[model samples]
Target: MAFHEMLAPDYIFESSWEVCNKVGGIYTVLSTRVRTLLNLFKKDKIFFIGPFLHKKESNIEFIESETILDSWRKYANEQEGLKVRVGYWNIPGKPITILVDFLPFYEEKDIIYFQMWEKYHIDSTVAYGDYDDSCMFAYATSKVIESLYHFLQLQGKKVIAHLNEWMLGMAVLYIHKYLPTVATLFTTHATSIGRSICANNKPLYGQLSNYNGDQMASELNIKGKHTLEKLAAFYANCFTTVSEITGKECTQLLEKKPDIIIPNGFDSDFVPKGKMFETKKVKARSVLINVIQKLIGLSIPENAFLLATAGRYEYKNKGIDVFIETIYRLKKTYFDRPIIAFVLVPACLQGARADLKERLENAVSSQFPLPRPFITHELVGPLCNDPICEYLYYLNFTNEDDSQVKIIFVPSYLNGEDGIFNMVYYDLLIGMDLTVFPSYYEPWGYTPLESIAFHIPTITTNLTGFGIWAKSKGAKSDTLDLGVAVVERTDDNYFETAEAIKNIIVKYITKYDSSQILNIQRTSCALSKKAFWSHFIKYYLQAYDVALRKL
Candidate 1:
């Protein structure tokens, strides 16, 4: 049969821990793809299943709709004794969502685990921490799916339960056993062993081809999670991953070659256009400058370059160490222009600094150096314990008089109430002159894509899926001329990566004229257009076809 001429699902039920929770990159994957799904199927035909902690907690992302799926909601609750709330996810698509309360399933966790082991050979007895919660949620989600399938009287109808990550793996297993008619697709954003190897400071890319996934999982003490992820990949009708890099990891670490590669795509509706874009950029730059000057008690130059590296505070994995190293190198080698770099990585932090808050409010500048001068927020523990803070102190990248490259650590989530900028991340991202994400271990980088979407040229490593995609589309070197610099980053090239980034920044700040810089920004914006959901949604259609064909 031709690939394009395969069966399509009548009802699509997608589940993720980050459906409306907004935890990490997975949230970006599911939320952004909603509109495309809605365009393919009617709003009522698409359903999103997520874990429901509380109404108060999820009120921001979910709007309870008492009318939609009213019959199945009641049936799942009364007959199945399941707790579920049907609603609409508060995104652009506003698709139907069912947030299932999984707390009740914890009481029968043993039976659930036993059934999983007996049927699918998934061992959950050694699982700890969030495993129980995730499994219970998966069990609840499966019950919801089964109840809905029977209640709707669609026994043989084409239904797909697409689950994301190992957290929702049990849902695939449950559907495989109980609702065998439902086609299942499982996508692992990053395998447990691959992440563990990187976290342990081991060389992942250099030695990836020779590693045994099960052995490495035991060594890393992640056997339970790895087993579940492996089982899901093995049992699902179609197992998939986010990017080509992650597909290789799945093949080596999980021992299962993916049936398809569904790279993540975004909706560009959030990006401002024309004058609005310029206005937003100006406002963001103003806000960023004000915050930095207040925190550092120094008047930054008018032509200072505002650079940033933002994401989760994975010091080594996200290449935060390399970012700091590049800044230090820039300071030591080239001080021709003033550069202010923001490490917008959220860490375990206390609230905003009291003294800094007072200084900002009172418009006072301290002549003496403040404790942890480069950091905006107070650390929860001793400053020496945090890797980034410790490294900054060791390198003396303190925003003192002699240092031309000033670094500010914004160690709080930018959710419009971080007590510092009080602005969301995107509101601040537009202000950046250049963004860098030299990730040592990124499955699919959203930060660099976001930076380019804002018309800001960015530098990322070739290890990332997005970087590889950019390279395929003519990103040749670590220079602003390409708009997106896909720096060659192997496991052993830490210092080399830092040097390459330093040179890129030096070239951009010194050599590029205003018109040239504007052209680079235009190139970045053009590259972002190629990654929109409209261009990338066909890969998802292909994945669905693969799953249905397998069924």
Candidate 2:
């Protein structure tokens, strides 16, 4: 039995998007790891404390956590910078305590967005030059931690605050000064500055010589937050990054060295636990038809080859342009099928969205078959309209024929609405012949890993943190002949991408034998099993054990 299972603490407090809120990979970490973490500890011992948007309703009752309130009333009266409300509300089905603030920053006359949708308008800079809603988000997080610590102290429970990312890193720093007994654990999944420069193909440091250096510097100045990151790195009792490559980059690029490398893993159990590549032939075909039918309704070819690319909206960084160019060139030259590439890429579509759309369309010449000309299709058709309906409408629309060359560009935020988001993508992978992720910078890609898990051979670049690890572990790459191809981003030719796509499409169209396809599927399952949960969850419990021992 694990040491955590033995020690079974009185309480475990975790904060991230996944628990009650979810953003990206961090959400996965919180949801997957925290559940297992709770198993090691007691269920009642864990409390996930984070700011709840007042509009977002929860089943937990808002009983005045008099302990937290009393502690905060005293602390707030004493400190000036820490002037904030600290109270608790019970989340239903569980004794979940939510730490919230009703300070000047959090004061709202009327909450505009009750639903926790990623609102881009709120992301933009205000005319008054005030900070974005993210600042309030950061401030509220600090207050939450403060409130939780106070509650813990009043109960005489020793507390360990494990913070994920730089925003929470700041909160840890704030609370540590006041609470000496607190053990702080900080994890930087990816630094914003490192990611920005890497994605833009600029030097990680130093100005771009040809452009406005000052303006560029101002836009890319992650130094202020990173200083806090570095301090957390040096000061925190424990620090970890998601991948080994990212760990090195944190030290070398961001100057915030990580003490440990907790390479990210998926909750294998959450994904359909089955033979990874069992193609329910009829079910697979039906799913394929359902995906293609929607595109055909949009005038795309029913038999068009579907090669998908889905991720967050950083198009340039996610290598959407590269994926588009390859598809466009292939559609123009090779197989004369009507190509429909669906883009489920998400961005804050408030300002530059039109620009992003225009850029994507312009990149792919309008001389193709459809009125749009470019193959890139949105899961949610346009920027306007209710996204839920947009997602549902597409999901509900289906075609009679299943086979088509469809590429779905998925934006990151899927609220489990329209059931189609994750389901459709999975269908595309199992039914479609190929998936490509030509990322220039990925902290740790779940897409290609997911693709392989689904029994679809994927083309991933060397630049991705996962790809690097795969190469080290002898993950295969073929000249368009086998399952799972790894192409080096820096070394591979631009034409090589098109050539590879053509070869794969031709193979599928001409000679994808059942045995060969099944072999690929089985390979995917083998890979998935190799990276199972039992192998990794212990690391989290162990890391905490080490951290507490240090304390």
Candidate 3:
């Protein structure tokens, strides 16, 4: 490979805090991409590095295995004093994954931070909470990379180290300093300061260009993470983001325009084939309807519409605030059938509601609502001060017999054993007639993409990355006709955004009959096919090319 030509990577080391760990949207993004990545790169050459927590978690979730890199593993353990495990990740491709036990690095954190500050100018003193743990993991990942690079003799080869998020920012800086031969690509899913501003209820979109990221980070007390991310972006050979929306965010907040935009692509395998999809839909809808019926003690008709809003519990950021209000508006408007909205957000919880579980198990039906009919699980503290729960209370959702509109708060991860709805999130998602993620500050918005993949027409605002991409791909402006409704949203137009989403649903249900509805669902599935990694992997290849060319 020469400096004049675009270089192809012979090996790629993809590192993330959520490589095997199922945490957030990054997990979904990476796990789904392994198969497609393997198609372009050589087999067994792409390695994913993640943090190793404990023996039990490793044993349960990982399959420890032998690979050609065994020599490097041995060297890492004996010379580097690093606890590491080489295994196959339990996801789709089961890609070769190395989980480093980063706990040992805590003893040397101070020295490592000092070294980082000395070399890369990263500030670690102001870091708090998960900062130290993430940095330690990142440092350990860099060490693992160093050991593997020498052992594999990849010095002259096109070796690319792809690091994701600020959690792995240190790895980017470390690789650049220690292994200059290895091209580093650092992708920030979202700018730390941008997310912090939104999480703090500040108007991000309305005054984005005017806001100084450094100043906001200082005000938000996230300078450590912010500076780490900013410098990492500046240091990396290639800095990329998930979408153009986040690309602009990275430019504005991190002050470094991304080298490329690697839009998130879904795996077709997640969606069941032909009859399997319908079967899963039947099972999911059955469980969903049964749970709501048992809790609300109402006969939820077989054809009643099932709506959902699921994601991280960023109430204002994810537009859960607007969603709750939309449900109120939807309720105020007349609908001929029963409409039930499930808020599938994981939050602080004790356990499943014992009463609801018993009722679901017994197949009990009642004409009266339970004490806490609005929520399926019991929150940690007394009826609690949860925003969603409180807002529903504020709206007075009675789930009454004649109300025809009901909202249920499922404050648990729907991972097959939430004790109430024992189905996984996807299995449950396939059942939804419509999904809404009116996110105010969504960077990439995977929920809507997931919903559309499941062939469920979804409503999201233009403020989201997926929404922007969908619009560019000719997603209808104010209709569910294209399977996605990208509603207009701004910092101040909360009510308008909510009404727009509600109106899409209302119009969708009122205008289309059974056949037209099925066509729209199929159209959504087809649209999602355009976002499959098979199609979007070209962008990543471009990133890889650019990264190696810089070398």
| Candidate topping lDDT | 3
Each candidate: RMSD: 1.6, 9.5, 1.9
**Global local distance difference test of model 3:** 0.88
Question: Against the correct fold, how does model 1 do in TM-score?
Answer: 0.97
Models 1 onward score TM values of 0.97, 0.70, 0.97
Candidate 3 lDDT tens digits, 413-485: 9888899998889999989999999998888999999899899999998999999999998897589988999
Query: By summed lDDT, which 10 consecutive residues of candidate 3 come out lowest?
Result: 1-10
Residue-wise C-alpha lDDT for candidate 2, range 207-289, written one tens digit per residue: 32233322332467544454445565656777778777677667665555676677666555434545543444235545544
Alpha-carbon lDDT, every model: 0.88, 0.53, 0.88
Candidate 1, 1-551: lDDT as tens digits: 45348677898889999978877889888888898878888888888999898755647899998999898788778888988888999999899999999999988988988988887666676667788888899889888888888888878788888999999888888888888888999999999789889999999998999899989988888778899999899989999998899999999999999998988898888889989998988888888887777777677776789999999888888999999999989887665667999999889988989977787677676565566679888889998899998999999777887777899989999988887788899999999999999999999999999899999999999999999999999997667786899999998989999999999989889889999999999999999889998888877777788788788
> After superposition, which runs of candidate 1 have C-alpha atoms over 4 Å from their true positions?
1-4, 55-58, 363-369
Alpha-carbon runs more than 4 Å astray in model 2: 1-10, 58-132, 153-158, 203-219, 273-305, 332-340, 347-370, 373-431, 479-483, 491-512
After TM-score superposition, the amount by which residue 36's alpha carbon in candidate 3 deviates from its true location, in angstroms, is: 0.8
lDDT score, residue 307, model 2? 61
